[model samples]
Target: MKKIIKTVICIAALISAVSCMNNTKTLLPNVSGKAGEVIIVVGKDNWEGNLGNEIGGLLARDCEYLPQREPLYSLVNLSPGAFSDMFKLHRNIVIFNIDSTVVKQGVVYRTDVWAHPQCVIQVNASCADSAIVVLEKNGENITGAIEQAERNRVIANTLLYEESKLGDVVAKMIGGRVHFPVGYNLKKVTDDFIWIADEKQYSTQGVFIYKYPATDEDPFSEENIIARRNVFLKEYVPATAENSYMTTSVFVKPGIKFLKYHNLDFVETRGLWEVYNDYMGGPFVSHSFYSKDGKDIIVLEAWVYAPKYDKRQYLRQTESLLYSFEWDEDGNDGK
Candidate 1:
């Protein structure tokens, strides 16, 4: 069997890693052309063969471009402002997703200075490109794909404290589809989380995983725990039992430190999925860390059916909140 390597990272780590080089900033890169005059056409289909070529030709009929061979985009003569404005105007027109195939919303070229900003980009030999571009890929689930893509773009668009550092982080994701949710008010999230009163010490973040079968198997039951633990330690993998019941994990950012759950039973949500024939419960083993500036705490969590193993992928697939914790500020007030 192929090895399945799983890893988890919070928003803090993401930002910190991306901005690993302290020289980058939130302002858009310098551009050499006009942004408003450009229009970036994302592929509505798997534009691998002649399809992409045809679309490029059709768009070129109206727009002009510099003489170049093997263009990465269908159009590129306009400046950053023009490119971003055009996307905002007709982004909904070409939103498409073909089954098993890939449809891409070409990245956006955006900058703060909208009026006739000089443009500079990758092709420039010695000038800095003052623009930010991001891609939107429509998956098999088109609506969900777009929604997620929008969220990704929104997050990629946000330039917070040391805000300019985000560009470097995204540049690394040049050919990948790692998506993130966006637009929620990111002010100290304080719901379900009662309080964080400690200003002197770092708070804790954690996750807990429990096994629940799709069939009628009580996950919290003692018999189920013993059976699953044996299967995991002896077999090195989770064996599927009847009814399809499986495991899940919950992530949280706490104001105070949390103790390990050697043996604890948690109440299930009042949802249709919770009412099953068999259910088993378990405790939590959390991984804790501090924020970049050390003002906030971050938790690294996963479920261990056996020592040194976690069911993080399962929770991310089923519940969106499974891997989510708090995203705190660096407490850095830029001077």
Candidate 2:
């Protein structure tokens, strides 16, 4: 009788475990919308009023370092009534709920609400003015959330179709690993510098990885970073014309900002690059950070050259790869 009881208890536990797994499993559909697109849901009055203008200006502002004016995100505004099932599947969504009965008066961020890999930001306020205040207070957070969502999507796709060989090559060069999607090839590999690119007929997306000994001086300074970049480009990257090489453009000054991602602190620089003796130029961004041992400053830079098409998407795609970088000891080297 005791043996029979033990078997029954074991069966019951297995059944309970299966039940819990079923309860926790969620089968969400894939997200909709193209890369760099956002869906904004608001009332008609709010959409036409100052609150809408504020949201639009904040989210659709010009992307930095682009040669031509391009909004950071392509926004699509729809009224609350018009926000149907189809629109709920969008990758990025912001819903503004401003009514007298609203009990909550802040921003609430959610993910994978209606679709997989989606970002849904809901703002609840008592009135339009209050909504504007909330937005103003959390504007940077809002923008960052959506930007991260977009980047995560890119990183996901990259991992799905990753170029495993490139990770090995990068690991050997920099003592770290970076996930490179298919279509990219090793353009050049040297002792201290590595170049990987996806060259097409009309466009070129590339990444450069190099390291230098860290000094007591501010190695992450803009002047030093740019000087190092110019040196590397002049030596390794060349243009079609004789004596032409790539370098940072002096027409527009580069901007630098300190950012922390996944506990790694780095200085990000954004600017344009031009061929020294040629007319070709485009946008470029780089992240400079200390190596694992803090003895060297490693730089990962991404640049886009798409003279015939808009560069915002191209630049974002290439730039996303830089964020996928991981040190070998971090245990993501397989990625």
Candidate 3:
């Protein structure tokens, strides 16, 4: 009797382990389509009706910072029955359940339903009209979640990349560390500033780090930050033409806001940048915050110049580098 009881307990434990494994498998990192691609799983009949148009208008909106027109996310529609195992692994997805029995129109947000690091939103309604209303009501939340997931992925991939020596180099010079990608290098360095850029054939992206003496505890004002940025860019970042340098465009007023990232308070600035004497410009973003020692203020700026392609993805990839900033404890090597 004792042996039989022990055998039963062992079998029960084995089943429990298997159940846990099954539950955790979907939480594994999702392997799916490229960023900005969302799979829409709905019936074919609804996909061609007014409901489809509403869904498209919500999810396929135009992205900002692009030269031409490009959807924020490309939607690939597939019938519910056809949403096979292959489609289940997508990073972002939406499903519509339009049935009379659903009673009320509603939207649901899910995570890791089929794959790890995945977002799945389901809209259920009694009819096509109700479904459209549901989508219209929750469109912003749906798109915002997708964008946040993409940003998180970018940060994750950058942190997982091999630690470049640039982090340590910057730490030694400026007392701050950033995870610069493998291709970036020190384009220009000065006593109080450093410029790092990744120049491609038709796209050029750069990040500049600098520090200056802080007078008091007053918050950085928009006018003061812009003036300082103009001075620094004029001295360090130059265009291909003679006597031309990068500066914030006066046409579009720069925007400033206070935000906290990675537990550090920073004054965020965003605006269009233009070459003073040249026909070249793009979008730029900066984060200004006080240093740990309270003696200096550090500014980290990221800018892009992609005239031929969509600047949104390029700018996002470059801007994420700023959030990777971390202060080196020992102040020796930024390892």
Worst 10 residues of 3 by lDDT: 22-31
Ranking the candidates on TM-score from highest down gives 2, 3, 1
Across 159-218, the per-residue lDDT of candidate 2 in tens digits comes to 999998998888886778889999999999998899999999999999999988898387
Off by over 4 Å in 3: 1-30, 43-58, 65-69, 103-107, 124-138, 173-175, 214-220, 293-295, 331-335
Q: How many pairs collide in each candidate, listed in order?
A: 45, 0, 0
TM-score of 1: 0.19
Q: Is candidate 2 or candidate 3 better by lDDT?
A: 2
- Residue 298 of model 3 has an lDDT of 89
lDDT of 2 at 1: 100
Q: Estimate candidate 1's alpha-carbon lDDT, on a 0 to 1 scale.
A: 0.27
Q: Estimate candidate 3's RMSD in Å.
A: 4.6
| lDDT on C-alpha atoms for all candidate structures | 0.27, 0.93, 0.83
Best lDDT goes to which candidate? 2
| After superposition, candidate 2 runs with Cα above 4 Å error | 1-6, 330-335
Q: What does the lDDT read for residue 266 in candidate 3?
A: 96
**lDDT per residue as tens, model 1, 295-319:** 3222232222211222222222222
Query: TM-scores, in order shown?
Result: 0.19, 0.95, 0.79
Task: For residue 325, give model 2's deviation from the true position in Å.
Answer: 0.9
